[model samples]
Target chain A: MSVKNEKKFNVVYGEAVGAVAAHSFGEPSTQMVLRTFHSAGIASSVVTGLPRILELVDARKKQQSPIMTIRLEKSYAKNYEKAKQVKAQFEEVLVKSLLESFTEDLKNVTMLLEFSKEKLAQSDLTLKFISGKLQAKFESIETEQEGNKLKIKYKSKKEMKSARTMFVNMRNFAIKGLQGIKKATVQQDDDGEFYIVTSGSNMAGALEVDGVDKEHLYSNDMFDVLKVYGIEAARNMIANELKKTMDEENVSVGFRHIGLLADAMTYGGSIKSAGRHGIAGNKASVFARASYEETVKHFVNASVFGERDPLKGVSENILIGKQINVGTGRIKLAIKKEDLKKVDAEK
Target chain B: MVVHEVLSESEAKKVSAEYNTPIDKFPKILQSDPQVIKIGAKPRQLIKIHREDPTGKYSAYRYVVESV
Candidate 1:
């Protein structure tokens, strides 16, 4: 079989945008975030705008802007993806650690405060230290807006729960530095760390006992706003790419179609599946055989697994859908030699 | 002299950038009586943080960046 004829890989592409980097995620957080990574770009790109992420990165390095390349020896853990994962992992670890430390059960952990890994204006040891601390679990973290103040609803559990008790616990936790936080001139940790919740700056090493969480923070749109921002900011770039792709391939696709394609690309960069658990619960066979089994676990109800709905509602393909053994119909692939020869002769 | 100090995961990076050094090449661990060898007159590729200055900055001590 010809590889190109295979539908294993669906290149769902998107454009890079910003609230600023022309169309990259370099935009500040004050801007609106996209719901799904702009899909409208990639479907068009191979057809108009540009190529895709791989191609986009290539074009960027070739640009005449002196290539804003910062040479670091071995800091692979500092990229947007790695950093975001690290932050997320840290939250998990922090909560688990805190629960273990306090010998208490875990609560509904929420990332009350969030900042873009790319938006930090400057970085230093101090910022890293403080961030490391915040990434540690402090019980309950929620994003709330109170007039102009960003009320980071925090609830810790080294003890009991009460407004005054929570406040006192929070205040005490503030005073005792988490070992190696950064020192600031007008330290905000005095009142708390929530005050320093500014964008384009890392919260590491910037906190002290004197810091106030409220003082440092402004009204945040959402904790995971950056997630949307990063995806949406790619709108223009997505549009241009989709335009190019569709035009080149002569495949007319609307913004909605491109949007679906973009979402797949941004998250996993494939367009061969759809529905609720399409990418989340189960991956297609193309991803890997292991992915197929995972998909089975995600969709079908087996004796091993209780009854479950396959998110394959939108991903049903009759030609090669390897889901069931015997359902409404049967799939027979054992072809005899005579049938094969007869079919070949007809073709 | 090689400035040896503690750096956060991010600062550890900026420090390397400032020095045009690779992160993998940065001094990270302490050896028990580390075998110090002088390769010609060039300095040793080592960055050790003093016990006191674990804050990752210029502390009350001074050290030379030497090569083994």
Candidate 2:
């Protein structure tokens, strides 16, 4: 009895689950706005809506703003000063912001860089550090520091125009934080626990942070998650992101539907979108391929390759005006009364 | 060892044959599902699950399914 009850919950015969899943996700998505404004708060303010869903389904590698939430060791997390220090380390201090004024001496072909005592202290930088990083980055660069002021002179005789660009580049140089991470902030939760949140993602580098809790660190970038935690974790992240996005829109969707979408996208051992460049574009059935997008291209390609459509899928069957093999259409019956009479005669 | 075991290629074929339908038509479990991973099941591979019936009248019950 239990076995029979359990079997009843299974997918019905000939159910076109793929089409159903698509519709289940699609209808609700139409009500969703093109882009939802970022809600300001401690939580991830990443945009949610159709654009985000499209990006996730496409399995894009780079997101608009890749943010990382770095959980700290309990000892550091409990202390406010320690959390500040950790956060400070992740905050990027650009060289340009430190300068009080920039002047280029065209006659001497020398770029003058000056800094105030308070600005240097606020930036947590010194003349020596700035000069050293600059010298390392450029060839034949000379630096002279007199107190808080630093003068940069290029050894090259030509290219006065390139001097301004060089000065701009040097001014925007990052003096603190890991490369690619633009900003970092310290946030306190309801329990008064503090953690570092970053504007850009660099999981591998974040793991190296002294007080970072490696296990608890997470980033919004799916590709980074895939790179750091294998395909399984990446698939879960995609599914969860999809659900979360929809939930924020006050839309309800079955997890199984989103899970199926994720599984289909990741079944090939990697993430692929449901778009033309990904899973749907690579279908084996010629009719199925033709039904998606670029009907002529698919038809031409199939003809060139002599490809055959077995009409196994719902799309192709529907195109051919056949009963789609789903629900009742999936079932066929064959009965012969003459065979029963023959069996009775044999008996 | 995993709590469930994934069916081998031949076993998956047999399970599909018993269902009298294509593998895709069956209920799905993600390849990343914890049990599927524990059993080292890949996509399209079937997993055999054994669970103890809560009623105790039927102590042993099993189900086989393909991983998505």
Candidate 3:
């Protein structure tokens, strides 16, 4: 490379590119209203704009909505019936949805359950299975399937109050599908390929579903991705999700800036927010820490811990009115008369 | 053993001295980068990436400092 090219590509010393990146992202973001829009027909249709980006950068533990997209295998994706079967497996079925009505007796509780011949056969659910599941929890329970209605009688020594609570508990018991996932539906994408979209994220459990395409599965939650695919995948997810949200809002920010932010968030091998509780609050320089937030707290901690600030960074140097160690400030020149004489002699 | 190893304190110091660049200013690689994990590289360690052109006649060298 020529000296001219080197000068062209070289970042000016003390330029504070961090501030430049911040301005690039923040200026356009001000024009965007902090709102989320809904898109119809899309399974993962939540379009949270700037607020979502803030949450990601801050590395908030809880998000507004956590969703997962589970793509099925090639064969299953072509068949509507196969996709429905997979979706059913992801549904969280409660015992309450199965029961019609219940009455409490002195020593036994009697319950009536509505049955659908076609639906039961489709879900592979039988009265025998339900009875066995109930019996597993309650010792003395009997079931009688009469036509379309099934009656359950529970004989336990517990009192009426506790029996009623037990009855409520039994009603909420899961008969099928994975827990945590409230709803799942098979939706066709732009390519006409079918995949399951879930309301709640349960990556590990959803991956266990038969015919699920492990490689293509995606979740909105960064931690869930980290738990299943390790840190690299999570970092990529952060960048991609952030970019998608930004693009939806019609705001333009360079991908490299977002990549840099993601890299900062996960540089420690663990994901951290750029908030007070994470990186900003834990700066090495005392002035830098005090400048961000909770000024007194940071000062008090530094004082009590006998911390010393070297004042090497841009933030601390700017705070204390010192030249920051960047750009031209990074270079130190010391020329002696003897050295000048030597140079003159060499010439 | 992992192919990527975190450079020891002395090794990191040596690399910085050789390049005559501050460690912080070195080209960055994330701790979550797959190649960094495969070699078990950590923050502040210098990583050397060697690649060859598809034609097999050209080669390239790049260095990255792992950061979190």
lDDT leader: 2
**What lDDT is reached at residue A14 by model 2?**
64
lDDT of 2 by residue, A27-108 (tens): 8887775334443343655656777888899888777778889989999999989998887777667777787877888778
Ten-residue region with minimum lDDT total, candidate 2 chain A: A33-42
- Candidate 2: list runs displaced more than 4 Å: A1-8, A34-45, A93-175, A332-347, B1-68
DockQ-better candidate, 1 vs 3: 3
Residue A230 Cα positional deviation in candidate 1, in Å, after optimal superposition: 11
lDDT of 1 by residue, A144-250 (tens): 43322223444453333454454334323431223112221121233332112222212232222222231222111111211222222232234345445344443
Give a tens-digit lDDT track for model 3, residues A240-322. 89888888878878765676677677665568888888878767988998999889988999899999988878888889898
Q: What share of the true interface contacts does candidate 1 keep?
A: 0.00
Clashing pairs in 2: A14-A326, A14-A327, A96-A171
Query: Per-residue lDDT for A158 in model 1?
Result: 32
DockQ of 3: 0.13
Off by over 4 Å in 3: A1-15, A34-47, A94-175, A337-347, B1-68
Error of 1 at A92 (Å): 23
Whichever of 2 and 3 has more DockQ, that candidate is 3
